[model samples]
Target chain A: MPEKPDRNAIEVRGVRKVFGTGENAVAALATVSVSIRENEFFTLLGPSGCGKTTLLRLIAGFDYPSAGEILLYGDDIAPQPPFRRPVNTVFQSYALFPHMTVAENIGFGLEMLNKPKAEVKARVAEMLRLVRMEQLANRRTSQISGGQQQRVALARALAPQPKVLLLDEPLSALDYKLRKDMQIELKRLQGETGITFIFVTHDQEEALTMSDRIAVMSAGRILQVGAPRDIYDRPADRFVADFIGESNFLKGDVTGTDGGRATVKLSSGTEIRASLPEGFSPSGSVTVVVRPEHAQLAAADGGAALQGTVENVVYLGTDTHFHLRLDDGVPFIVRRQNARGGADSFAAGSRAGVVIGGDAAQVLRD
Target chain B: MASAEEIARAADRKDIRDRWLLSAPALIIILVAATGPLLIVLVYSFLTSAAYGGVEWKFSPEAWVSVFLERDIFDDTLSLADANITIFWRSIKLALMTTVVTLALGFPTAYFMATRSEKTRDLWLFLITIPFWTNLLIRTFAVLQIIRNEGIINTLLMKAGIISAPIQILFTDTAILIGMAYVYLPLMVLPIYASMEKLDFRLVEAGYDLYASRWQVLRRIILPLVKPGVIAGSILVFIPAIGAYVTPSILGGGKNMMISNFIELQFGQAHNWPLGSALAITVMVIVMIALLVYVRNTGAASGERRG
Candidate 1:
């Protein structure tokens, strides 16, 4: 730990936040602890009511933890108010001051810090430039479009140079195209500022696109934390694999075991080699998770493959998905990249063999 | 044969005309019933005052002149109308004080009401408007019973050993101010509450997130956003307080005669019909000025909001 290179910017140590009192109390966060590194873009991702926003609010000092320490650069910030903390939030609604001009909104935080007027002006100009909103600086927030207002909210939060910036589903309000653009823009801003950003989102795609690391949450608990590639490739559990993307789960028995790898026997009597999660020793029964793109349909000429019948065919532009039912009645999908004559290669009501690629199937821990 | 487009255009014109025709009765009633008395008052102000307490046929500017100037009996020289000016100034000052007092009391009340749950907010608003159900005269009398020397306030104070005797508070400017503020408080609270309720509390959260203290948030964000309601409430209170008759007549007694009382004296005891009309017109002018300020302020604020 002493030899670690990157310093921790924020350390939430054994935090618990329970709303209400007595029997009606709901635990929004149950003994959650995490360490976010300096200049890292960390994301807390989950579905709605998954306590991601609750954690963000606790970090931003809008609410205090029921028990535990929230340390910012090794100092406890749990007892501080939002204004007293060196953290700012870009709220979900954007919450731009409607009465003030974009420039005024940007400078509001700097002014609150008792910065010199000239310095505030300079910083406001710099923020407006950073957000590419110099043209609309003199316009009221209400006069601007929603995307522009979002930029102002970002600029306002960043004006005072907070050590940590919290974004609460900031892109959720934007349309699909704008959201896509802002995902890149937000990543770029984080890189440029070098400020530790703790983002809360329910969108897995957004978390994958912008985060340096993601903590997948569910029911007020962090199930796993890893890089996007690590998460998508080597999910820690059934929930992580199922929540992150599309997966086909097949019931299987562990026939053999190796270092971080296991041979699983499916109900169809086909043996498939799948990788195990770290420190996981599978026994009699387990679930084999496979992605559709990792599997393919082959001729059922009595080859060494799983036997299944093609139920339907979906011809996407770049790829075609073959919906198949295994001989044991477990539905499975196989996606093949479409080439010439590949679109209608497999028709409905045809017998096919299912081939799962090596290192593509994982033995998931339930 | 005419085309369908031409027929539709003709129908549209006829429909508009029919709509106006349908509204004409209400429009006519508003014009005649509202403007008729104002027109009569304006005309009366320009006519000569008869000795017997009505206007004469001859046209004269004496009533208008006496509004701001008067002739000395011995020297026969024109001098500033000190008596009328004092009464007019006192009326304006009291109206302003009433507006300030109600605002001081109403702003926090409205903010508290707006912050409550929607179901409870309606109850609070209903309570604020309970005064409106009772007659204005009766409400003023209720205030009188509370503040009078031998009334509830003094009696309670004496019984509690806080005072040796009853303090005379009934026939004072402070008494009139209290009555006017009590009567007009609902006007101030309703508009401010309307604005505060529309306020997106997330902006207050945003303020705190941006390092603003609670006081700073109130000053920079909450105050500016709710200013339109403040201006509206001030106008509502000020206009009526300027021409307040019952509250002042009862609470102020004879010693503190406001512009309304002075005007009444012109028609009742002074027997000068033209002067009374002129005084009434002056009060209208003051109200018009207050309304103008309100329009300009809210207009600018709304334009910013809309833009």
Candidate 2:
């Protein structure tokens, strides 16, 4: 056998998965396509039941696509069994064998191949060290804590040095503090291992913190695939803009277009201009997405520019958020830092002025 | 002038008395039903036999010595002593054979049932238990019908022209084994199924995901996980098979005389009560020793140290 060239770790082309037949059929993935490069930390972020984990299984060879093909390192792997494929998965449950010790669990695959006893022992020891669980090597799975068991599971999966690692909500079982800590550890581990990681999660914050590139999915379709900053700063449509992070959607109509910029007239009778993204047309109903921190609040008696009344106010230690209702009754939220004496301090139940510029918002054409 | 400590002690005594009162009736019944017979068996094993076939006032080891020494005091041409030893050995061998066969057939069937969908598993479980629904004697006789000479098997063989005369199938060790295994197969399956069903299948999948072959997953992960079930099932089948009397009697047709048959003969036809009691005592001791050895070798008792 000849050694193959380095290629994309996983490539999925037009994959479709239908759960049942006839009247009960559900199309879980519809012509979904993406390629995960080697050594990249890629996330498939979606809401629940969005076919993200299904896509990961398809790439790992645990499932077969009803209609398209999957390739591992440039060779078609759609027909290969999960064991034969050079991919390992960290399941959501951490599925460690309850009867085996931590060492035995880590060395199971090597022992399965009838490797030399000394070699298996050495590899198991090395993996234990890698996961910082050397002291727990002899402990039975039932004796360990949840986070420790998770590390043991990860060591077992990574011991084979697979070309790709698939993680399906592996951190969902941990506590909030542990989950946050593990996320950073996982990102660092991925960088050190340098294997392609296709992570499936429904958490947007986690996805934003860890991924090199993310594929946002909805209703079994890939809405956008780009760097985290691109997906967050320049979303493709209304759904992508609202799903990735908090955005105050202002319903408006496109008034004019100049190059890549568009001026839109809001239903509140305020004209806000924003730089339109590539291929966005001006002359139809559109919505502008403004981040809360981008809008400023000013006192109504100061004769400030945009007019509104403070509906609600929340002080969050670092910043204060004001919910402003304009004359047209359209609610907009504005966030301001609690700086000593900068500007624009409005009290609740008082009139306020909201100011937003073109660069602070993005026009979303649905 | 009672102190607080005295009052507390009185209350504690009352609580203990109340608990004992609640449990007394059930405990008394258990003692009568279980301990009474056991104590009688122990006392009878040590006592000397009276000439009129009742208990003697003297304590003696005469019965134990005679059984262990395999003496033939009667010195008749057809010695009952020789027959008893032969029957005891035959029974042990048949029981061992039945246990092995049952485990071989039952383990995989249990695994298959455990891994199936709930509805299909229940249907298969029902099918496995169908033969057990009939009386054990009726089922043993049904085996005799199938394998006896001039029976269904011999008739089919003759019609197929495979043999010149009816082959002798019953009245042999093979017939007794088949009957015993058929009767005890369900006993073996249920325990194994319970254990295999509790196994976490994700562990097996994890084996595969880590690049283990299918055979490796089965041998290393699945087999170890279900070992408890196998041991439990084997004990369930073997212990009962050793004491089984009706199946061998009907199917063996007097050719395969096990220990129970000899005990039955000593009491029923031979009119020797001392020897029958001796044989029963010997069988009980042997079963106890076998159970102790099994528990030690399997480390099953140690595994239960948690609870």
Candidate 1, residue A180: how far the Cα is off, in Å: 2.4
Q: Among all windows of ten consecutive residues in candidate 1 chain A, which has the lowest summed lDDT?
A: A1-10
lDDT, candidate 2, B66-116, per-residue tens: 564554548723224565567788888999999999999998899899999
Compared with the true structure, model 2 gives a TM-score of: 0.88
Fnat of all models, as shown: 0.79, 0.65
DockQ top scorer: 1
> Chain B alone: TM-score in each candidate?
0.91, 0.83
Query: What tens-digit string does per-residue lDDT give for candidate 1 at A99-204?
Result: 8889889999999999999999999999999999999988978788999989989999999999999999999999999999999999889888988999999899
Best by TM-score: 1
Interface RMSD of each: 2.7, 4.0
Q: What is candidate 1's local distance difference test score?
A: 0.91
Instruction: Give the RMSD in angstroms, all C-alphas superposed, for model 2.
Output: 4.3
Worst 10 residues of 2 chain B by lDDT: B71-80
Q: Candidates' lDDT values, in order?
A: 0.91, 0.84
